[model samples]
Target: MIDRRHFLQSAAALGAAAFVPLALAQPYPSRPVRIIVPASPGTAVDITTRFVAEALSRSLKTPVVVDNRAGAGGLIGTDAVAKVAGDGYTLLFAGVPHLTTRWFTDNPVTFDPVKDFVPIARVSSSALGIVVKAESPHKTLGDLIAAMKRKPGEITFSSGGAGSTSHLCSVMLNDLTRTRARHIPYKGNGPAVTDVIAGQVDFTCQGAPSVVPMIKAGKLRGLAVTSAGRWGEIPDVPTTAQAGVADYLVASWIGALAPVSTPAPVVERLSEELVRIAQSPEFKAFCASQSMYVDIADRRQFLGQLPKEDAHWKRIAQLSKES
Candidate 1:
């Protein structure tokens, strides 16, 4: 006694209903998110990322964790993130090294830093401080330069690694002043700074967050900061320009990135959350405490600057080779 037409319509309606749940499935980040730090735990990038992750966890209302994959000067962790699915679940807490690593290395790099990743946000930037042991005879940046000139390769400087920003800073210093200094590479900036403290190395150029507290505690003497203006935390420290190195300006920036295949909506959401966090007063204060300043740049802005950064570092690498 079934009506044929009505029965057919009912079946069709049921078939369509079955797909509704699938279409209405959860949005991006329904599960925990992991941010990979491509350096040791105590590095400046790691410290800044922990702060961002905590704020992001609250903003997204999801658990955000930091995974350190330190080795090969940040290549391991960065390449790992580049290969993952772009589902918004995995991200990279990236820095200057992210752009400069490939240029500095002789081995084949698996991922293209610019093409393989999408920018999320840029959180903070800090000047590098040229520091030495408090007891060292070189009291100022000029003194250090003079010593390097006097002894050429005899005076030694330590860095996080050969291709690291710290190393590039020292290289730039030597090139600018027409001087020479022995280069010592360490696994991480913490150890490099420690060696300078232990008197094993003559000096080191490190980010403010890593060395500012030590400078305050009198463990390290900050000869000059590699910025146009002096760092607020170490107000007395002169800028490189003021210290007679007129063109030796450098700044280290930290930001977030995801695999390029990530959906536009997901990338937008992450960028919005990060921008919000960076603009918050609490975050600003936190960055200031570490001698960094909150530099909020969302996805578009961050992407726009990548090419310029790449060019700058490429030039730096050439300078290193020439020297």
Candidate 2:
């Protein structure tokens, strides 16, 4: 009984209603994004994340910010991101420490390290160097190993903390080389490396970026690099394999992650942008200035390798306890 005009108008209204959802569903990054660094500002993790955040802002045409949530050895900040909505707004700028945190902590962590997050991309990694005081008699890695063997648990090695990358590096070396060296835990990398320079500690397995300057200044001796290849900055120093400890390589790396259940499309977009940023010349230059190297991997590569790294660190942690 309705007139043609009235019937046509009602049909048009239903059509508009059907189109509303499609129009309202905007693409990702409709607003600002935040990359959370679970470490203090000025630390390596913070610096790396800030660089990526700036790059992402340019690529995504959105305002990307870095949020420093430093506390409780990065647990507080990491947990914050882990528990947030899977909306692609919050991300974690994490490195080796993040993977090792739960293994070392006594309290139960709130999220599953392997299941609670989606890998975006691996940013970069800094190689660990085997270093000793310039005046130390142990001139080579072999000499240091021999000393540790001769006096098991007598020679001391310093690390940033109990479960830091430095600590696990030393522990892994001990396990593979079948030597025993006492571990001395310090508050941070700066203090631990400082004591090594002061000859307070026998040696330390620390990141090359932090120790390269000391080596250049003749304050510390670079024996070997714990990387597959010789570090470019210290090309003369042999790799762990070349120095006789076969199959030894370790790097402190940073990667980006979104909360699990974040849409696959969102994850893909983030991964694409991150891969671009990591491969950019600007990022390489920044890494060189910081004594680090650029090692980028896409989402699939990162996700595939994460489980192996987790197992590797777990074994290192167990070795630490035995040592």
* TM-scores, all models, native as reference: 0.92, 0.88
Report RMSD for candidate 2. Answer: 3.8
lDDT, candidate 2, 1-323, per-residue tens: 77999999999999999999987588788999999898767667788899889889998899999999976567778899998998999999988878786776777899877789899999899889999999999999999999999999999999877778888999988998999999998866888999999989999998865788889888999999988877777788899999999989888988998899888889899999999888889999998887678988888999998899898888888878877
Cα lDDT for residue 128, candidate 1: 96
C-alpha lDDT score of every prediction, in listed order: 0.91, 0.87
lDDT of 1: 0.91
| Model 2 poorest ten-residue lDDT run | 69-78
User: What's the true lDDT of residue 98 in model 1?
Assistant: 93
Against the true structure, candidate 2 has what lDDT?
A: 0.87
- Give the alpha carbon lDDT tens digit for every residue of 66-173 in model 1: 999998889999999999999899999988899887876777899999999999999998889999999999999999999998898999999988779998999889
Q: Which pairs, if any, clash in model 1?
A: none
State residue 98's C-alpha deviation in candidate 1, in Å: 0.5
Q: What's the lDDT for residue 233 in model 2?
A: 74
